[model samples]
Target: MRQSEAIACLREKGYKQATLVLLFAAIDQLAWVAGDKETVGNEGFKAWVQQYMVEKNPELLSGATAADLWGARCGVLHTGVAESNDFRKGYARRILYASNYGQVGSNDPTVLTLSLEWLGSAFAAAIVWFLSDLEADPEKDTRAREKLSRMLVDQQP
Candidate 1:
């Protein structure tokens, strides 16, 4: 299924955590698929992370920053814990959102620090921007179509 369709389904159902996880996974998966799948916790994935965060965190993406975010990703996917010490330490506990910290715990540059709402917005915005890019580049559009088709359809005969 298209990432846009998945985003729409999440928005329609108001699936906050699901949306965050799905989009984060999508960005991470692209990095691995196009970069190196074995570089999850290593410095080798830093470039991919930087590229992925360019849409929202461009001015702040770096090796250290990517590692911090990867820690969060690891906590969720590998450990089933959503706690990132780097993230927790990076952000202040006092940042308020309607008298609370909001869906995300912090807004610190050292951390990914994105709220559920922010994730939805970023995902939607990135999709739009990327689609526009594809429209302008037929090669990219064709490659994406082929890749997506290979993913969604069984090729065994």
Candidate 2:
């Protein structure tokens, strides 16, 4: 999809933090690919996501930090390593829940409203990053960087 259309769809989806995170992951993966061809296919894109996560978090799940868990989820989803399921059972739901939350109640308002708020802010920052055209205009990109930096610095708990 086109960038504007994709962003509009995201906005329509209530801008859920998880979806934003995935979009950023896709953008990051696309950025690192040397050419457009390398990024246009599912297999290459999946490998890019996995490599990005590995570069960011070499340990994968065994020794992954909280930040690493987010990358790992993107890697797992982008990779169609396994498929098929049983009606009586549910593996996808289990993976989905695990990928989206670090701890139980971590994303829910009732358990920790602050976390949800912070997640929204993080996703907003990611949106800015995903949308930036850094190569075409460095000055504009720098301003965007400063804006995001200020947003993050102000958000410190």
Top candidate by TM-score: 1
lDDT of 1: 0.50
> Model 2, poorest ten-residue lDDT window?
86-95
RMSD values, in order shown: 6.6, 12.1
Off by over 4 Å in 2: 1-14, 17-25, 28-33, 36-39, 58-94, 97-157
> How much is the lDDT of residue 61 in candidate 1?
29
Per-candidate Cα lDDT values, in order, are: 0.50, 0.38
> Candidate 1: misplaced stretches above 4 Å?
5-15, 29-49, 52-67, 84-112, 153-157
Under the 3 Å rule for N, CA and C atoms, how many clashes does model 2 have? Answer: 0
Candidate 2: RMSD to truth:
12.1
Clashing residue pairs in candidate 1 (N, C-alpha, C atoms within 3 angstroms): none
